[model samples]
Target: MSEFETTGPERAGPERRPRVCVVGSGWRFTGGLSHYTCRLAGALADRSEVSALLMRRLLPRALYPGRARVGVKTAALDYDERVDVFDGVDWYWLPSLFGALRRLRRNRPDTVVFQWWTGTVAHTYLVLAAAARARGARVVVEFHEVQDTGEIRIPFVAAYTRRVLGALLRRSDAFLVHSEHDRQLLGDLFDLSGRPVTVVPHGPFDHYAVTHRPSPDGVFRLLFFGLIRPYKGLDVLIDAFHRLAPEEVSSFHLTVVGETWEGCTEPIEKIEASPYRDRITLVNRYVSDEEAKAHFAEADALVLPYRRSSASGPLHIAMSNGLPVVLSAVGGLVEAVGEYAGAVLVEPEDVPGLADGLRKARAAAGTRYPDPHTWQRNVEAILGRSAAAAEGGTR
Candidate 1:
């Protein structure tokens, strides 16, 4: 409880729920973290008094890759009704920050959880964390990735992030991550001598699984979905598709769906120049929820050949929909989907390995994988409760 607890009526009930405030990027940015914040707030509301403090503006539109579609509603997810929301603090707006502080002061949550994914919100998070700690609220920073791969590529932003993250982490009471790999990476990357770190698996992003509709053209459909980044290894998949046998290439169709980022257009160029150009479909833009649902529904399997990763929302989407997944074995991915019934793990950057995995996915096409993850388990871990207690055993 640390200094966050006060003997009051709110804590007097036999089944008193912890008051928690989850802070993260708002839907205006509309990506993985946005979905996660909404989903997490909903799950936490089941057993805790919850509030969502979101950052409406992540950065200037010119710098964001998907700036053209910023603020467009692309997801079909929202916060739980029981969870109060403050739709958020902006980069240059001092009033928004003050308003967020006021929300914290008024609600007085017992726990303040910050979803850490980028350096853009580091300064704002520091201010909120300091305010929360001063008022006796326990702070938790959940690590989605040690650092954003795109941001880390820049020398100056990376240095600033390193310093700001150190100070922010020093103020936190505990830490939460998606896997043991991430837990080890966090400790190795930061100074967490006395703080606790809990590994809570990422919950399913099943909201996109609206229906099942495999390709009616009789060709095997393979999907590569998400933001197009260099580290995601989309080029490797493109190369592997080209290397397939003529018969296999003729019978297979590859759908590359997602907006380009970090000036990554090599894969797109390769797809355009490939011999089997007609076999590949490139959306080359951010998609709406309906579009995503259609893509997932029509695909035979989902493929993620990330050179490195922490945890992936697309992987969970496939699992939720029972679609076969062909992904690279790297970072937290091995622990995340290795045991799944429909997962085929390939070595990162290996063209032949990926091609083989693709063939395997095609063979298992039309089969579905049962969803194995639950928000209940994720909620219990964040609140530091046992699975038995979450499932109705004595707390």
Candidate 2:
């Protein structure tokens, strides 16, 4: 038997298991970062004493499945939990930054994991991580995407943000990145060498075991799933869909399945008023897990004409459900898409290229998706390395 299995139950002993805490906004809705945190926490919980500090904006039942699966402890803080929309993980809401810090100080976890994406939460996590380090706690920062010099438009703001990010990077003991593109950017932007930065690619759901029948198929279905934002390049997708020939339009239908974050709906509204109005469907609302599964199962292919993105959950979800994807070759997306037998990669913001990708994806539909075990193995290797590093072991 493997070392992990041989020790199995006995490995939970105090000397072996470390106290690990993950501090994040919350997990009441399905964001990529939130989902990533939950998955890691759940996986680690089986091997260590893992807890997550979440903002109180989640349903107790929705957030915490049960204490049986994982020893999940939740504390709710005074905040508009409604504003925090994440699901599938339990969160303890500490209302103010000070309250969060106080809780961390009280818990005194051995290792504190911080999830970072933007500047809004960077300083908050930096303070918490610093406090944890002051208490002799190890801090690890998991970056979904670090703003690149090319993607930053405002010079002064970008510089200031980079400075703040640098401070945070310097404070952490280790780093976790989703893609090689992100790892290179972290190293180049923050000088993050010699520090342990593990690359853990996200995993897809195993759809082969689940018997979910597709929706009645008269209309050709195309789905755009995830938070509707300008950076996601929905406008480019709409334009590309609009430019499709009438015959092609007749053979396909577009479904926009996600809520608008920055209230950017002008482009979508324009599409609604266009000549191909009847060919498109917009379910402009927060999609639940069931709804997401249904959409993926029913769709012919997932279209992600993202203008700028580091990684995508929708693409992973679609691929997991045995559906093919057509995404832009921007950021780490190319790495994630890899040379998968059942996926298509296109250039960023190229409407004709996107349309051609869509055409190709349709032509190559129903092929077997990439093996989920590949992603699982990647995740295992990263987590194992992170744990080993935390324990002062070599990679």
Give the worst 10-residue stretch by lDDT in candidate 2. Answer: 1-10
Give the TM-scores of the predictions, in the order they appear. 0.94, 0.77
Give lDDT per model, in order. Answer: 0.86, 0.63
State the lDDT of candidate 1 residue by residue for 1-395, as single tens digits.
Answer: 32223233344235667888999989998999999899999988988899999999999989899999998888777788999999999977677988999999999887889999999999999999999888878888988988999999999999999999999999987777877788888888898876677776788887877678756777899999999999999999999998898987888999999999999999999999999999999999999888988898888899999999999988998899998899999999888885588999999999999999999998997788888777876677666656333222211
Q: What is the lDDT for 66 in model 1? A: 93
Identify the leading candidate in terms of TM-score.
1
Model 1: lDDT equals: 0.86
Pairs with backbone N, CA or C atoms under 3 Å apart (clashes), candidate 1? none
lDDT of 2 by residue, 367-392 (tens): 55754423444334333533332211
Clashes of each: 0, 8
Query: Residue 21: error of model 1 in Å?
Result: 0.4
